[model samples]
Target: MTDHKEAITILGKTIHLGESKELSFEVAKLHTFNSVEVPVFIERAKKPGPTILLTAGIHGDEVNGVEIVRQIIEKGINKPKRGTIICIPVLNVFGFINLSREFPDGRDLNRVFPGTLKGSLASRVAYKLIQEIVQEVDFVMDFHTGGSGRFNAPQIRIIKGSKTLDQLATKFGAPFVLYSKNLNKSFRNTCHKLGKPILLFEGGKSFHIDNNVTIHGVNGIKRVLHSLGMLATKFKISTPKTDCVFINESKWIRAKYSGMFKATTPIGSFVTKGDFIGNITDPYGKFNHFVKADNTGYIINVNELPIVYQGDALFHISKELL
Candidate 1:
């Protein structure tokens, strides 16, 4: 018997082998009565393989991942060798326009997954994503960044379990690989329940693009595609000089007192317990207090904003594998 014709439908458009299409999923209506749509990009290869999804901007202000996806599409690097490649550069169109992390209803989009049809605006957006885009893929890569004033080192985070996902994270080749438990109602947890492997890449800072992080992200994605046999070309992937640091535990270094803070160590700095990470000083330059690391680890995220309050997360430290 001849091979069955391969076809996949998204946003009501059927894409056959070796075809690429752009479609929009209407998410909501603006105050001006205009439709807000989530743009989707799809590429299918003539040969059969695994379908993978790349999603970014769920937090809206995470611009590095958005730029990385845009560059991949603009540079024509998204052509798949086999199977399909689905890209959703911006999932929260409303939050993106407002430069906010939450929807107009003040709900965090990423916190409400597998949402409902008759729910609130955030829930409805999440529902559409799960029903339309997420259900169509076998694997997913969700890109994110440190919130607001924080900057993150390039890293890949995978929930515990799934050898396949671990291998994929290693292939992505980020400097750090974090194994953690999934959050309730988050995309990772939702996809895991559906038997799908999802890898989350956190890098840079919100609202601005970090070229270094963006380049690293693009290269890592290409390597992943190649490893999955989805890249159109047979090029050797470049391996990083240092192996990825695998960490199972991490903690947030919170400020003990509110003040104007200055960080002494940058993101990606290796630190020992009791190391002075930064110092907090009163606005008038009186009464200075230092913050020290409670555990030996690498700084994966650092708060960039000078102003701080007591108990604010100033640094995120992940234990380094020895």
Candidate 2:
């Protein structure tokens, strides 16, 4: 809780206490002289509390997070009882518009941290976010999804060695929690450097919205808010019966040969070493090649696309904590 009260400003607009507004920050301009902006939804409570930031659509194709954030806003999360909730439903406007994963310049937005004003499009946008949004938040939740043709089981990826982040992830109550190394130039690393706790939720697949994943994400956010004493009233926080599996390491199963692939095991399935994960058959049905797990682990991500090439990532397996 903060005793000192002051108005929050963004995009040159001042948001007073107990007020909520939809604002946009201009990030770039189009060839037609139109402006492209990042939409920000702010909800400041009448009472003081920790400020939490929730962002989605860092990769434009990841629509699950975008939809999750949208539902939270529609459910009136903006009308908080205490503290503030800042939601940026879509961060990469250019990628979102084109339905692509990265910026138009082919740079992954997630790989550019604390960007520079004079840098490329992705870098500039990252810079603006770091300067204007990330720096002010006490906590953050960045949502993500698997790449195209891959489905990731709903899970929380927390940074290693941060008890604060781990506790928040536990309160968030995702089915799986993985302690992952912070990637260089990623938002998670940048926030960690600034001494802010950030939790990343990876689920579903890019360009598609899975209802179960979306619902879980929405509830997880609320649970975290309640845990932080930012939620105004008490509501039944959803808890899964299955214990969350904590893992420190994961590996990907790659295709051994190119063919039309069919996965026999689904996402979230547990498999033993050498267990058949899928079978790849020639287009004409002349030959078949079986894909097997290299280690005993839980399948967190699986490729959904039927076509496969040699060395293509087919499954992501995470070793459960003993």
Candidate 3:
């Protein structure tokens, strides 16, 4: 990054063995007519092995994901010992440029999969990715962060009942692994349909980069590469601080009333049923409503936004564990 020897063709460029190249493909242009190209970084090892593709920034505001990929490139982690490593730090260039979550056309890139040739901009880009890049990689690792003001504890998401994914998620060693069904038309679903094993990582929140989340992400990548024998000898793998938890089910704690909300509980912590965890208050000297835990489970996500409304998701708590 695969079904080839000595060389691989990406965007019509033939990259031979042990050769590293920065190639890009044109997607669209700005209003000024300047061409916009999405860069693809490729690094191949002299000895042949499986190819792994690392990607992020499908949602432009998820800068933390972009940072993780950027660190891989910056630290030469993309240089594999025996296999090919491809890093696409930013998949949605338009969204990244505008610091927005969706494409310029207001379409979510993750919702379009195996896109059509003559579709919307995001769809076209998705199609190109599948046809040109996804077909070449043996495996994939996509990075993401929470949307809105929600901050997520480092975690991996995969469909339930996959032994292979369970092993990989354990190897990833994030604090939590949540079993979830794949969304229709999602990239993960498309890749799974094509027989590609992919890991989806979610952490932190949009527009903000947290140190702990970044370290977890980078370490997870190194662990996966090391498992494949692709990690460089110079890089040392770090042991995870704690055993990863497998979540079989989870529920969102929604706001009961609209007000300025503040969470007293931290992410990734367990709480008993009806425990006081947060509060809601008005700007003026008004009544303060104390929020309680819905059940006894780990809080995986917390909405950090100060303002809230009725029915707003406040926290994500595990409902069942494996």
Q: Pick the candidate with the highest TM-score.
A: 3
Whole-model lDDT values for every prediction: 0.86, 0.86, 0.92
Better of 1 and 3 by lDDT: 3
**Worst ten in a row by lDDT for model 3:** 1-10
Model 2, residue 19: C-alpha shift (Å): 1.7
Candidate 3 lDDT by residue in tens digits, 1-322: 3344788878778888799999987888778999989899999999888889999999999999999999999999999998799999999888888899999889999999989899999999999999998888898999999999999999999999888889889988999999999999999999999989999999999999999999999999999889888999999999999999999999999999999999998899999999988998999958699989988899999999999999999999999998
Ranking by TM-score: 3, 2, 1
The list of candidate 3 runs beyond 4 A from truth reads 1-4
Task: Please report how far candidate 2 places residue 304 from its true position, in Å.
Answer: 0.7
TM-score per candidate, chains pooled: 0.94, 0.95, 0.97
> How many clashes in candidate 1?
0
Candidate 1 deviation (Cα RMSD):
2.4
The segments of candidate 1 whose C-alpha lies over 4 angstroms from its true place after superposition are: 1-5, 234-236, 320-322
TM-score winner between 1 and 3, please give it: 3
Error of 1 at 106 (Å): 1.6
| Top lDDT prediction, candidate number | 3
Query: How badly does each model clash, as a count of residue pairs?
Result: 0, 0, 0
